[model samples]
Target: MASSSDPKLPPLMKAQFLEAFNKPYVLRSVPLPTVTDPHDMLIKVDAASYCHTDAVLAAGQMRPNPPSFPHIGCHEFAGTVVALPEISTSPFQVGDRVGVPGRAFHPCGTCFECASSPTAEDADADPPGYSVYCPRSQNNGIDAPGGFREYAAVDSRQVAPIPENLSAVDTAVLMCAGVTVYAALKRCRLKPGQRVGIMGCGGGLGHLGLQFAVQMGLEVWGVDNADAPLRLAGEVASGARVIDARNVDATEVVARLGREDGKQDRGDMGLDAVIILPESQDAFDYGVSLLRNHGKCIVVSFPERGFHVSARDVVFRDISIIGSLVGSNKLLRETLQFAAQNNVRAVIRTFPLSRLNDLVAEYHKGRGGKLVIDMALSDGS
Candidate 1:
């Protein structure tokens, strides 16, 4: 291990590790991570957000390469830098509020994706950049260790500074939900004033997507059949037309969408794009039905098996079905900045680390918002 760390820190810290597939996590006192690489930083992880990916991993459903046994969970983490690297030129400093996005880590500098860093391009080093397409990169919590502990060692190069208005709890969601939907919106390629539909609008990512879509100047329609999620959609984006897909007829939704500006346009002139978040095939098909010709259908959900879309409709309407993963490092920074300036935030319920097993048990039973583990709440909550 790298010796470059705070000598005053403790040797070990509490963490939750997935000891086996299809089993509950085990608590252990693991050695605290150290800042080894010049681009590394040791973080006192304040908050780690639970995600669907964690549920998938727990179910032994990870595709291609499986996660190692006894792996640390939680890819969406935010914290203060307790120990900084020896390198002075890094963007971060000691005590900087930061977050490491789940998908963008361990980027090989020479790759084409890393070279496409949106914010800055450097000659001597690979700038803190995107690794979404980097073949050699390791996804945090999958191929590499993640933040499910009191403290975590992270790749500083892939970390985004948290906005001052946000706490680590809120920033944790930004790492996953915010960056994810933002990247999905980018993939939609919808212009300002065009219409966009968010299929799972009441959940954590969906509500946040509504906020971001409105801020992006797109007219929004949020779809959810459940009571809790529809309530959340109304609470977060009051201006949006929140539709209950179970009750509302598709023609009515399309008609209402067409008449938004009082011009009474054709019902078939539907949304410019649809951002799908749920895993249900019915939801996917309904979302596609709401799209106009040549509309972009951006898929964000990853079910055990994929959902089916009508091939005839897709070909006839010229709809572009695209898959959007989490954003690159540069997109994470941009996403946080947007959230900070626009007051966009996640409505999260905080639980102490000790209650992780309880949360994991109920994770897929159907909830509407974000759940997070707050390290500060270590008081047996």
Candidate 2:
């Protein structure tokens, strides 16, 4: 914890990152983020999450603006606000525990898109339709130093105050992965008694999606490759169903869901929507096959390889494919509330921020649930 009066704090803070793609994230010293504007605040990072996107950044692909040699990248983190601007309308006060979604530090609210349903619409809208095709993407990792450090600077609009009682590790994933899924589900226009299928439900974001879908009055069917992730997904989303992605036939599984299954008593075409979060193109292909007519597939992953869909299949099925980003500040707040209310959270393996490089390698193994970097560790653990 840091005090607002600590003007003598270190000029630089410890961070971890790879100098380039296909390298390791190692500890290095970087300038502590400073608050230069009234809407800006400095946070003492308590915990942060490592998503698949972080892995891609480490691997040197899909980074919008690759940081120069020795970059720090971590987009999702929970912390305490230690500094505040002189004049602000944000509900947050200094000392408030909060989470910063490692996108941009702040958003420009004056953009035409941001003005209309700012929380639901893209803020990068320019010239209407022209901007729709190429939404203005904010630069966080490339343009600004991201989390993965002891402290971060965030714009008030990009910050969400988290419940003090929630575990920082669990809430950390919510900052990015959790909020992304929640936002995608909202876009699905889900209804009570609707059947929802989540591909890659064992994943960090997928697992949270399953939990959210179940709590939101949908019957969830989680599909994943591993037995452990499948079992864990079921545990996280009580009464939600699971399918073995590697072995199960997509059409057969959809058929089973349509018919009453003894285990969950779910029947088929019963599905109203589906969300896909996978790094592989095959998952996208399979997700389309499982949807019922008029079902929506909300995609929230950036695959290393591009996805190719058959025009005939899409046209005939009346299925819709949509993409979503991390989420708006309003959605982030809703994520916190949903998690607090339903006890939905990430199953995290904690590591001291000091051991970030080594942990990045470990996370690459893909055996853990979620890995959280605890920046507040004593002596860097």
Candidate with the greatest lDDT versus the true structure = 1
lDDT of 2 by residue, 1-381 (tens): 233335766777888766777866777787777576676777888898888887877666765555576777888888888776555556677778887776554445445554454233544222222111123535445445677888877766667778867867778889888888988888788787787888889878888888888889888888888777777787777878888878888877767766664334222254677788887778887877777777788888877666786786568777788887766666788889888998887877778888887677777676636888886666556
162-193 per-residue lDDT for model 1 (tens digits): 87888999899889888899889877877999
For residue 209, give model 1's deviation from the true position in Å.
Answer: 0.6
Give the lDDT of residue 287 in candidate 2: 79
- Pairs that collide, model 2: 21-60, 75-102, 257-267, 257-268, 258-267, 258-268
Clashing pairs in 1: none
Candidate 2 Cα outliers beyond 4 Å, as residue runs? 1-8, 85-90, 117-139, 261-270, 378-381
lDDT of each: 0.82, 0.73
True-structure lDDT of candidate 2 = 0.73
